[model samples]
Target: MPVPDAPVTGAHRETPEPPGGDRPSRLDPAIAARLRRTPDGLVAAVVRQHDSGEVLMVAWMDDEALHRTLTTGRATYWSRSRREYWVKGATSGHHQYVRSVALDCDGDAVLVSVDQVGAACHTGHRTCFFTELPVSSGEVAS
Candidate 1:
């Protein structure tokens, strides 16, 4: 078994740890636990197009949602409005097949690159971030 706090190497990288723990200890549990969840117990997930590298949409994920995403090789999220778990494209047939998942160093956010099947946005657009905010002043934006 790998020692605690050690850098996991090689094939072990692909082997996800078994879920249902209070916190992950295989790597640095403290570091991973740094991920801040909202008072409602949610974190932000950034989903992207794997091949074209197009920015898709951002969503919220709870622990179960995140676990489902990792184990199933698909993008899953916690629907804040519906008050339920959602597998992307489950209804629209525009599913997101997860290619890889990465956590930022701060453990505050997740990036999921996926093979998007069709339109990623519910608005029938390729991405949800279609409208750009007007830049009133270059200095303000900078």
Candidate 2:
């Protein structure tokens, strides 16, 4: 599928209120049609710092979570372990103010650009990817 350069919500029509209890999705049909969900019905969300291009964290998002993020301009994710929806910064003061959101060419992942404040990791790291893996080359790849 040839994905548009525009964000998924760029031309989305306002739908009824988001999904209620146990409801699967309230995502716009157009957007939903473009997604390629996992067996558990989710897409990977890669969050990054807008200005610095620093990857902050990775999370999952179901259709409803995506809808809430798009509509609210906050980073909302489906907590796989917790099995619930959580908006970033809701509990922690570390907030991700959304700058933009775009689906990958494969429709299986999304890139969320945001103005991140405070720690973006559960361990209080600025980013979730703190530990660097040992590389055989030990040199930056050009």
Residue-level error in angstroms, candidate 2, position 43: 0.4
Per-candidate clashes, comma-separated: 0, 0
The positional error of residue 89 in candidate 2, measured at the CA in angstroms, is 0.6
Q: Clashing residue pairs, candidate 1?
A: none
Please provide, for model 2 over 9-109, each residue's C-alpha lDDT reduced to its tens digit, 9 standing for 90 to 100.
23243443233323367789999999898877789999999999999999998888899899999988876555567788876677889999999999999
Candidate topping lDDT: 2
TM-score, per-candidate, Cα-based? 0.72, 0.80
Q: How many collisions between residues are there in candidate 1?
A: 0
Worst 10 residues of 1 by lDDT: 2-11
Question: lDDT by residue for model 1 over 32-134, one digit each (tens)?
Answer: 4666766666778998999888989998876767877888897877665545567787767788899998887766688999999878888778888999998
